[model samples]
Target chain A: MENKLKRKMLWLDAWDIEEQEAWFSHMSLQGWKLIGISKWMAEFEKCEPQKVNYRCDVFKLNDKSENNRIEFYKQSGWEHIATRGFIQVFRDMKGDNSLEIHTDPIEQAATLSILKQDITKRGILTLLLSVITLMLIVGAHQIDPVGNYLNDKFIETIVLIIAYMSISITMVNGMIHMSKLMKRLKSGSLLEHEKSYHRKIKRNKVVGITVIFILSLWVLTVFLNLMNSLQEDRFPAIPKTELPIVQMADFIDDFTYIDEEGLSYFKENSSFLVPRQYQLEQMVEVPGETWEDNSDIYSPSISSFGYEVRSEWLAKKFVQDLKEKHTYYAENYVKVPESKFDELWLSQGNFNAAFIARKHNKVYRVLYYGKGSIDEIIERALAKAER
Target chain B: MANDQRAPMTEAMYYVLLALYNPLHGYAVMDEVKKVSNGRIIMGPGTLYGILKRMQQENFIVLDELDGRRKIYHITENGREALKHEHQRLTCMVDDGKPLLGNGDSNGK
Candidate 1:
């Protein structure tokens, strides 16, 4: 009486093409008629679930004889329901054997050989992609100074990995299952357990929940940011004058921003590229020079310029990463025993100091080298950061 | 796998050739073979198609007729000779087995 849509994880292997047929027939009979099939899920529409017989055959698609085959099946009283690539699904309206698609085990084996070949090709392609994607992730980690990702771009990195690996794993699973099915069929041990399909864990719900969870997290982050920006006293929007606050001129004395064309690429891949101001000759920096940039894309309302909100665990990692890659710096920074704030101040000389303080989960990184006391300079930078 | 020096044909292959002594298409060959072997030799579409193609390639069978989408094949002179040779080999084996099977429980002494 009404139309309804439902998604299901149809878990039938190569050996269970017959089971797939019977399963489809059962589905239609139960009124959950299959309307579409994708790589991951089967789409069904509700109607009057009537008793029917379904059959799936692996026919060579894009051949001249395909029409003849379809005609022959039509004459035999089977209605072609859908064509998924090479898989032809046909329904017997009366739930009777007007004709059989595969009549014998030998014929079934030949039919399965085609599927075996197709999946083998897919498996090889998936293996190549999985390896390449994994290598890229690892390679990205190596170039990244703070570890696997920038302190803020961690979610994006995880998403990239998951998207690639899910496809790879599905391809691999198909290849392996097809291989096992072919081996058993070839050996004449047709282990067709009648109800083995029912025991398979339905993962459609899990996939649905995961997608919802990720979307909700993204939405929550955006919503929180919107709320934060509206707070006048707390996390206010950045003023137009502060748009170019963190310029290359503050970090180095002579470097250009690699031209405007390359600037975007530079910011996106800053972890991999050093786009500092190159010293042409003797260099003089501007007074009150500080590099203040927030990398978090979700929150435009950065509460303070120098302070970065990160997972609490990353505070220790930030300091450790700095020490481990000390060879990249001009001078080694020794840890100060005592400090005015709950901060670890690492100083190269009396004039130069790096103040790292962890407040709750936020980390404040203050870099300075001047004639005035380090504490006073830190205070000045903090005041400007709040402003 | 060798030509001219043919290995003994399989049961399905042998009966298929026998069934195709008269010109017949795929389904007819399947039906005739089953009848001749008294329901023992059952051939499906895929198996018959595979066997017929292999036999045609080996020059053991030739396409006698191309009826619309159906193909009818007939055994060649080479095919008849191969079948006769296999029959003789099978008869010799059966004749050899008659003595051992006839004197039951003799314990080979």
Candidate 2:
């Protein structure tokens, strides 16, 4: 068989497709006769460096010395590197094959290390970008009014809930899948073996974006609806026309408003009056009797009218009073009986105005009326003097 | 079975060397191994490339660069020596077992 000049082939760990092709061309240029090429599996199978059969293609070139061939493989960038498996050499036996030579393949334990080097930078960036996208979605939820809408309404709530679940799943799954891909890179597993994983990433992106967009839209819709509801309930627009609005709890007597414009004007004016009467009224209802007995003046006009009062102006006044010795309407002083002030503030719009008398000292006070009987107002005024 | 267990040559190494003993390229060698092993040992393409590189380094084989895609290889003198040693070791053990069995001829009647 040696004298017959049969095809000779070598298998090596670093022999990728392109290198092998280039090597083949180089040998052809050197006047080696081309023969039928076959794969080199038998030799690798016996070596079994990775506890599995090693398979490699063997290109048979005739009229080439074995020494020159090995040199060719090395010089052509097909040099043996440490690998998990082995490489083998073979000859075309034709009819009767003989075992001519064999050697253990190089221990390519470092291929995994090289492969990881190739992918680490890109892999980390991809993971980082994914995390940023997740953070943006979470940040969006915090800033927009969508969360409240999702909680309150039906369609939007359901959609947001589903979106939340989907996004969370996609984010978690994508990270897990990506981590697995990184592990494979570290392990020196072939890229071809991991090709099917790309589709999973794509699917996750699609699902995640869909979920985020839907949730964002749901949140936006809910915010708009809330604004509309508030506008409708609080200060709805009315055309100029004659309409009767009877006096309710806020008026001293049953007064009729014939003009819609006038009613709107009155309600707008009501906002202004709400603060004036209620501000000093709360100070009189101080929780402790000691402070009440010590003070001379008190007022509870806001509570008598039965209006739901808010004390934004009053709170501002207090702040201003703290800074300045006196505000525009009243002098600043640290009123005792803080708990009484809280109760009076909470129920100011419903308490009888006659009962509220501003007490400045132990024996001094000023009486005021807010939709109360004249007799009650006179009695409260006289009682203040007696105190 | 005990002797099999003591085998120095692994199945992958044995089969890969066997596959390359024929005139073949990377894919062709893989197919040959699969066929011979009845698909029990299917060599992936990447694995095949890795093995080809390692074998070429140890002087066990030499690459034939005449073909572009299929880089062929052949066994070397040193490779042959190792293969022969393995073969002789198995052969001697088989020969030693002959004494225990009646292998005179004619089906040992």
Per-residue lDDT tens digits for candidate 2, residues A105-180, read 2222233333334334445565566567656655654454322222232354357457545645544543444445
Residues A110-224, candidate 1, lDDT per residue (tens digit)?
6677777887787788778778887887677656655432333455456656656666766677777777766766676543523334433345345445755776776686577
User: Native-vs-model 2 lDDT?
Assistant: 0.39
Candidate 2's clash total is 100
| Candidate 2 local lDDT, residue A344 | 18
Interface RMSD of each: 4.2, 11.7
Residue-level lDDT of model 1, residues B1-109, one tens digit each, is 1233668787768888889888886567768988989988666444565567668778999975475777678899999988888888777777677776763355355
> What's model 1's lDDT at B26?
59
Give lDDT: candidate 1, residue A103.
42
Per-candidate interface DockQ score: 0.26, 0.03
Report lDDT per candidate.
0.57, 0.39
Q: Candidate 2 chain A: minimum summed lDDT over ten consecutive residues — where?
A: A45-54
